[model samples]
Target: MSDPVRCMTVCRVCGKEDWLDVLSFGPMPLANNYLAPAPSYDDEPRFPMDVIVCRSCWLMAIRQVVSPDVLYRHYVYISSDSRQILNHMRDVANLAVTRFHLPAGSLVIEVGSNIGTQLEVFRSMGMRTLGVDPARNLADLANARGVETLAEYFGEGLAGTILEQYGHPRLILGRHVFAHIDDLTDVINAATRLLDPAGIFAVEVPYLLNLIEGNQFDTIYHEHLSYFSVGTLRRLFERHGLRVVDVARFAVHGGSIVVFVGQAESQWPTGKAVFELEELEVRSGLTNEVAYQRFAERSGRTMRELGALVRGLVSQGKRVAGYGAPAKGNTLLNACGITARELQYASDTTEFKQGKVLPGTHVPVVSPAYAHDHPPDYFLLLPWNYAKEIIGREKSLLEQGIRFIVPIPEPLVVSNESLKDAAFSLSHG
Candidate 1:
């Protein structure tokens, strides 16, 4: 069983004890804990899944803390699984190499480098690469693919060891991994130590503003301890003697921000992008509590709407199944009380997830090939972050009159008619 949920009395970002309740999903099983077939539900573990914001720092975070061991030791998600992610990682590597002026033979290290997909890009760019991740299986996969990876959690200790063994890295990249860390200080301190004098530390995380504005509550899982806006990220990095020199936004993963940091005393000047994003955050009311409250209200409404949509479709005798079994999808399913009764099964390309059942929901997971053989009338697109890619790839199904239900921002059905309407609206407007 996983460890009991530990409520935080003090905010991890600002050391303040004042917190404002934002959203709660009551008790929920770990999002990635896919169960064996015919497993006992009574023996499963659940923890409080509550979200709160630090009144002082304006940082959004989950109040309940789960052990990292339970979250990532044998992780199932692979970075290379998604074609969109692979393309995005290649773009990131190219940008980093060109923008940072990383010369050939410069060392690039990545934290949470699942299966070394991103690191492979850096290597292809003529840069030496290393990866640090806690998932032993993923680390082994990385090694097998010729990407040197360490099967250990990254922290000050591991950072020192890496520095001693490989010397200072020209670039330290953490893509979609920094938000999972509970100790921001330790990680930043380690990055500071492992960075060369002229090196850059680039970290990418899902943008808090996008999460709120897009009503992406499904992204709130135990693994993601903190949600960050540019303002909060600036403060966090500043506290560790690092300066945010540059910021870049990407539409991948719903929305993400890549913040490039350097030593506080470095000659690097803070780019206008950082100031612009910080200003945008203020304009979006991310510095206040009202935005979060509205987000919570909208989240509840989304849950109800998605449930209603799925049930309504089922009532019409239309078969519905989930398109992907992402961790975020589990949160959405469990929170909405959706079960195998609603979604017959979830189809995924990941072999690790095949034959397993979604936590709490008990929705069986099947291979994409199997799902195609027994296609449902409608597919609930679980990985809405990759909506365009998935929908485009499944064009044949849409042509065959199959529809997809996108449950984010608002629950809507995507069909040929909807596509034409959207295109017409955009072209006319």
Candidate 2:
């Protein structure tokens, strides 16, 4: 049998034993582990989702660490699925090439490059690109698309192999992947070894400040081992002989911060963005325990509010189905104890999730075409981060008097009138 999931004893960044309990969602199923219709809940796996913070480095992370093999080997999240993400990646690629002045044929490597979408952008820009991802299916697709990808977990050993075969990379970028890593130091060391002396390592992770401020408790799951802030990232990179040279914030993935790191001895200029964000982190109470306590309380309130809202709608004989079956959606559903009784089914575009039921709630996932054929009274916006884009996409349904329930930060129902006003504000503002 597989070993039980283990609790973290020391901080991954500072190796300190000091820890502060932040929040607990009791036991939750693996957020991305969509099950077949046949699997019984009695046999389904669940683990503790206790979030904690390191008092020494102020790094927030989950106490239990699930094995990466079970979490990522057969992943279903496709980066190319979202149009907004594609545009964001295009922007990221263009900025990296132009801002860094990456000449043609410069080797660029991406860790956890899902389906090689972003790396393909780099390849199109005349740069040599390599992608390292653990998902064999995605790696195969990436290779078929001409973006040479390796289906291997990256660490010190694989870093040596890549260095020998592909030479040192001019840029090593990981988008939303660093937070999933359990061994931050090992990954940082591997990155440091695989990079050229003058190269830069850019990592984009969900900003901790954004999580607390936006009350994005749904983003917490077992796969995401760590939550980062500019301050914690600075400490993490510095311990591995790398320095944060630059930082930028983006609204994608709720909110994320891309930190640019370089070898400490390198002459890369530290941008004002780094210092400015670090100060902001301190002023926002990210470096203290009180903020976490408040966040925990707020998360509980959100769960209760969302539960009451959905239950109320069900009592009125309203048919509510979830829109978008993202991993975070599973966390929210399980945490709030919402099941198939509340949400009939979750509609998604991803074929991999269409026939499978949600991790714990047993809410069957359906295709968007099927959902449209059998429309519900309200669509519980599961991926609330893209509320505007999703609401705009279903304009016809909105015009037909179908409302949407957005459950995050608070539970709010969106109607045609509200959407029009929002669109007008966006256009005029």
Candidate 3:
């Protein structure tokens, strides 16, 4: 099928190779298109969800334009759910306070602030806090929850609006939001205008090293316009008059880099980790085509084996279903070509997506109750991050000796006993 939406997807950080065909989730609808009714029989337009790579910069990206208006207009993510994430936000806030010397009453603004879970902590510390998010529903929710928010897309234009309404923020934070884009210049300009002279702009994104070494292709979706690394990110930020001062590798989001940047005009230590990571990125082969070639080759082998396993179970008439309709599940379905015939339905705890189908595979999403009443002979846990959580939550279902498979990072099965013991069930799927 021909692609619909027209989007120019040049590498934002560097003028690398114009294109590299990464993967194609054929004719997929929006990843977050969680509608109750099945997409009507009426023909619906399909935009290209095909992914690409920048051979020169070693950047992997998606080619699509669902427009932030349609994608992030009703943000559903909440930050406080994961204890690790909650603590990370508070720790970063403290770091900004001490390191940047963000004075009390000075502003701290977060672009793409979903649910204001992070900003609430900043507000408690006497910092004037503002949240910019396109999600209208979440903006109203944040306002009701006492975290003042502006319901609009953030860019240089929005930055001007903020400067006119509220004083420039002393600390600007964009977490995973940094990589969710095809156009980043507007955001860089926005940061320049909205930040005070010495203010720091901190971004936490999944390290490209993690994406490569960990085989995190599921992190590849339409929403994530470009996957970033210290090398690409530093180049992108510095080109916009911002400097990457320090970076810390954290265990969040598979593996991540928490980057600290300040005005190119400001004087900071330019920590050793800065150059070390850049060198490591080069040595790690992030900028070379070889790394991507290797990832794609290994992925081919991985998918064939797992696909055979699932197909075997299905052919045996063993009823199979899945848990956690995850983002990565999109890639898995496309790569392995697991269509709706293999699994009956997939279940997720998020109400916003309860009745929707997986974007590319058209796999129906059911509520968790399906596990208790009509459990499938086998259960597949799609979100490996919350595998333990799913195992714990559905221990009773697993007690029936239903085999649970964990796809990716090398597929493995969950033993019934181990699944029961891990009752935390705190899945971020």
Candidate 4:
């Protein structure tokens, strides 16, 4: 006899009980819980991260539900670290202002606004920006930097408070956060109530199609409760009396989309992109269980290939180091079973994560100066999504014979002459 399947039975979106088991990453710790003083490995907590597909709604999610308090109260991942992300947010804000005809002095509220990066961009555009974040430290930092932010989680109750204080917002947005909420129903319900009738409610999330097609299995962690597709998002929004009017794809965070939504009765016309993408997803079997099963199979092969590559390098007396200390990097390291023994140390630009050790693997993290002073034979590109930025910034290292190992869509080593001056090099073994 085996243990019973211990998780939610009903889907979060639709009240459907039909689910298909797709991928299981087994027991894993919180990806963002990097240890500053390096806690004892024996004391760390690991939760089962088995992902399942809701056949009725086509929503993919991890059944193991970790409380928001456990994962986000002391959040360490800040959006201000990457210049690329900042520039992307600026473009999003500018587009929103132009498309929606938002005037100066209009209210803009962002949920899960880490360090208020996006809100800062909105404020500079003459909009009165407000941020709601659960992380106390980050909220304080944002407030100190002139972004009016409330250190509280957004919910129906908070929505009432915002309406009372600031009135309805002209625009409400959440970037890379719509998937993290365990109770998205409450959040969406609140957002609809707080949004002005003609206001646009924009959200950016990791697209499920991109995740499966790009082989970004490492993005699956306890923090990300759901992987969304436009089809599922449309259904979810429609259920709340909101319609997704416009959808645009971006090359940020592997692949993502900014969905513009408004009240069902609003005048914003639905764009053809939404239906086109939805049809593409259906054609790709995104709503089918078999596609997810195949994704799981492909992910297993990737883990094995990445492991073999790292072990082979280590066996040849080559020193390996990680380029970034991101949460996705932690998931990739733990899923592939790489540790400090194989990867000597990881380098990061974030001052907070620089002196810490990775959550599960206990891999030490040091400043980029360390890697620059004593370059490793191989620098594993942990934040491979930012490969272009990293390679361009560290062009000198490539010239000094330090090769980069990109472990995404496929595992490859980059030391080719043609890519010496390029953003990222791709040379497969």
Highest TM-score model number: 2
Q: Per-residue lDDT for 59-128 in model 3, tens only? A: 6777665676656766555553656677777887887788777778988899888889999889888999
Model 1, position 138, has a per-residue lDDT of: 94
Off by over 4 Å in 4: 1-6, 416-429
* lDDT, candidates in the order shown: 0.88, 0.89, 0.75, 0.88
Cα misplacement distance, residue 323 of candidate 2 (Å): 0.3
Give per-model TM-scores: 0.96, 0.97, 0.88, 0.95
- In terms of lDDT, the best-performing candidate is 2
Q: Tens digits of per-residue lDDT for model 4 on 1-429?
A: 333223667787887999889988889989998886543678787888998999999999999888777888888988855787878998899889998899999999999998888888898899998999999999999999988899999999899899989998999999989999878889998888898788999999998998999889999998898999999999988988889999988888988999999999998899899999999999999978789988999999999999999999999999999998889998899999999889999999888887889988999899988877878999999999888777777778878888888999878787746484553443221
Q: Identify the runs in model 3 with alpha carbons over 4 angstroms from their true place.
A: 1-4, 7-9, 16-21, 24-26, 39-44, 74-80, 388-400, 417-429
lDDT of 1 at 82: 72
Each model's total of backbone clashes: 0, 0, 2, 0
Stretches off by above 4 angstroms in model 2 are: 421-429
Per-residue C-alpha lDDT of model 1 across residues 284-397, encoded as one tens digit per residue: 999899999999999999999899889888899989999999999999998887889989899998899999999999999999999989999999989887777777777899
